[model samples]
Target: MPQAVICAYARTPFGKHRGALSGYSATELGAMAVKELLERAGIDPASGVIDQVYMGHVLQTGSGQAPARQAAMNAGLPVTTPCTSVNKVCGSSLKAAMIAATEIRAGVSRMVIAGGMESMSNAPHFVRRARRGEEVSYAALESVLVHDGLKDAYTGEAMGNAGETIAGEHSISREQSDAFAIRSHALANKAWDEGWLDKESFPVGGLERDEGIRPDSSMDSLSGLRTVFSDGGQITAGNSSQVSDGASAVLVASEEAAEEHGLPVLARIIDYATSGVESHRVMSAPIPTVRNLLKRNGMSMDDIDILEHNEAFAAASCAIQMVLGVSEDRPSDIPIPFRNPCTVLVRVRLAISGAPDQLSR
Candidate 1:
């Protein structure tokens, strides 16, 4: 079996909700990242070397038909290239890459473009039952972002509320969560200032930097914010993931293809696994998932050098750390502002640094 490796990757700087990147649709953002990936990999647009395109996208209600196809066409990939849009919610883009790697490893594809994109700023609103031809006094408008992207379909509970439950179960305190949020922002700002984030990102919509980082974030400030999920919940807006827009793309190729094209192999895809837990314990899913991944790979937490668990809420990260026996002081190199899109960017950083690290989210 051929090994799959990442040859190149690029991402647009995450834009705050309704901020710099609001003008572009999700497909447009995806196209920009794909274009940047091709340029960085030194692949000519006309080469037709790209065998497939797989892009993850949520909030696709009004984005149109075949968003991945639109992104590929917009990025100048030959129309002959096949495109797939994945929708595993928060894991969409990461799962896209995983699918691309599986295809490459199985010898079905030689080269592929895989990543994720989202435009929360432009996610559409829906008038529930408006098209039913029923006489109603009012039509309720629902946020597609919340209804589709940020809510648990099975339980109808908001994701933040789920995070709150996880935090409560795990005994994660407000102070601890606040501290983690503060550290995340501080590290993100530092990464930007040190030029680490610049290597993997390209300017988009006149925005060259991530707009969500708060340089003045402090425990005092975070503590004062009221909780949005529950009456007295510890999960506050200051410590939760931001509503942001961004895109990321990576070129995945078989080792033989990389050698033939002279493309640099960033990192090899050793293996991947997925697991599930109770619906309401969504935030705790990573705990068992990571454990299964490590067990299957015959590795332990001690053997892993870097971990990039999603910080959807500070409580999620705190819960993972506590259960996995990871130290609270462990430093994360990348600032994960958006969910699926930023995963590819983190992989880019890992490859560029030439570290023998394993990433889990």
Candidate 2:
């Protein structure tokens, strides 16, 4: 019975781009989340039980050597702890936790830490001429910060532009997309006001709550905004994911190890999986991923109670909804860093285990 189990989870409140978290390095932000995870697990930082650290990140420009290692060190973990950095774009942190679960299932490591951190504002611009080895010429400094998330590798299309493409391909209208955005913001605002996020969120960089939700957002305003990616595009700032800064983390271990450490089982990691899509439709990979997960687990979309969609683009979520036939599910499109699946897993337990009081938030 030594299967992988999640014992504790925590996340820093998401900050806006160039907002509260802009000045800190990714390692520093990750360290705070890691420390909180250890605290929630009731395990000492110096405990040798932690076998490794895995962190996901996208904007790694100017982030120092072995970023995860640095984050663990900064969190007061022993230098002997191994660390690995993963970059799978939007799915980075989610995949990192899945990999940790596999390690626990394989019995290679009992206790491990997995999470992700991102600081879009702090991502550095680079001097490309230095790398190209030009002898003498006035050259412009290019920024990976700008290009990394913006440009797709296969077609050089910006993520927003691709969102527009998906929108056009799927025939998702501006009204429908705007409705999703408005509802997402409303739910986030309600969650913040009701303090549903307090258990999982802690203050970082002087920010105590999610900084991205627009409290005054309305359909009228969203309808008026011009599309930035293409002239006739349906995608706009209102309908796309807010560029954000924050981190989320969880402590995972085998079931036997959890008993050994006297830790409560927050959730069990089950049947982690992934799938691919056509190169051009990369944003919609979650459709096949959800289908494969359900099929292998011998379940259907109707068997599920809740689905939390990380908001990347309204179009992607809408398209996936149409494909997966889960459009009727209650809205749980939590923001990325503050709303990692580790917390979702825990919430699922609370919601289903008759803990109504706890699930009310």
Candidate 3:
């Protein structure tokens, strides 16, 4: 099989609620990130190098038309370059990248641009067509962002409620959740301070750093945050992931293309698989999926240097940790650490290979 490698990537700093990025639409942010990636790598999308563009988006809200095509055109890519949008919820962009890689591996596309975008702050409310009436009476209006994004149609369970249920099953406590949030913020803050993320971040609307990190946050402050779901639930506003806005993109190319263009390869494409958990226990899907990925690769948790799980709620990370028998300490063992910033959490298991020695150091 042919190989596809991610040559370069870029992303905009995650904007806080109604922050600087509010003015731009999700498609614009996505285009900005992709353009930045191409600029840094000196690749011209109009040069016939890019074969296709794949974008993942969860909520379009006010953004109109085909977001992927809009994003590619917005990024100055030739209109002739075909584009497709993938909406796999949280893993939309990641899945978009996977799709791009698959196309390259299948020998169909030589080079492709893949990424995801979201504008949670701009999520719009709408009234169904059936709700419209000739009378000037108030019709029922539903929040498309909330109902379609967070609420499960099958069980009508809000994502927060699902987190609470998972917490109860795994005995994850509020204190533990708080601690995990604190650690995450601390790590994020440290990374920002060290300028480790500068390589991948693009300046957008004057927001250069992640707006969600609370450097001064402590256990006391976290403990005081009210529970967001159940009356006695372990999930709290502080422990739960923030509703953020941002976009990211990566340039995937086949081995021949990469060598011809003199682009350095970071990692090779490996096996990818997905699984579905019960609607009530949706967060546990990663447990079985990761297990299957590892099993297919003939490896286990001990063999994985890094296992990046999307932390939608503190309970989610805890539940995955418990089921996978993985301790948090092992993450540092990997040479490249991934910090995912997305509302929907997609479990990605990357088996690192072919990284330069500078990264290992």
| Predicted model with the maximum lDDT | 1
How large is the C-alpha RMSD of every model relative to the true structure?
A: 2.8, 3.4, 3.1
| Whole-model lDDT per candidate | 0.82, 0.74, 0.75
lDDT of 1 by residue, 1-361 (tens): 9999988889998888898999999999999999998999999867899999999898888989999999999999988999999988877887898899999999999999999888999998888677898664545778898898888899898878878888989899999888988988888887789886787888986899888889799988999999988987888878887888888898999999999999987788888877788878888888888899999888999886666776578888888888999885654443445443222233445554434333322
Give the per-residue Cα lDDT of candidate 3 at 352.
22
Model 2 C-alpha lDDT per residue in residues 286-355, reported as the tens digit of each score: 7777888989999998876556666467777787777777764554444432332111122222222223
TM-score of each: 0.94, 0.91, 0.92
State, as a TM-score between 0 and 1, how close model 3 is to the true structure: 0.92
| TM-score head-to-head 2 vs 3, winner | 3
Model 3 lowest lDDT segment of ten = 345-354
True lDDT of residue 40, candidate 2: 84
Question: In TM-score terms, which candidate is top?
Answer: 1
What is the per-residue lDDT of model 3 for residues 119-151, given as tens digits with 9 covering 90 to 100?
A: 777888876665456343245667767777888
How many steric overlaps are in each model, in order? 0, 0, 1
Task: Itemize residue pairs with steric clashes in candidate 1.
Answer: none
For residue 280, model 1's alpha carbon misses the true position, in angstroms, by 1.2
For model 1 the TM-score comes to 0.94
| Model 1 RMSD in angstroms | 2.8
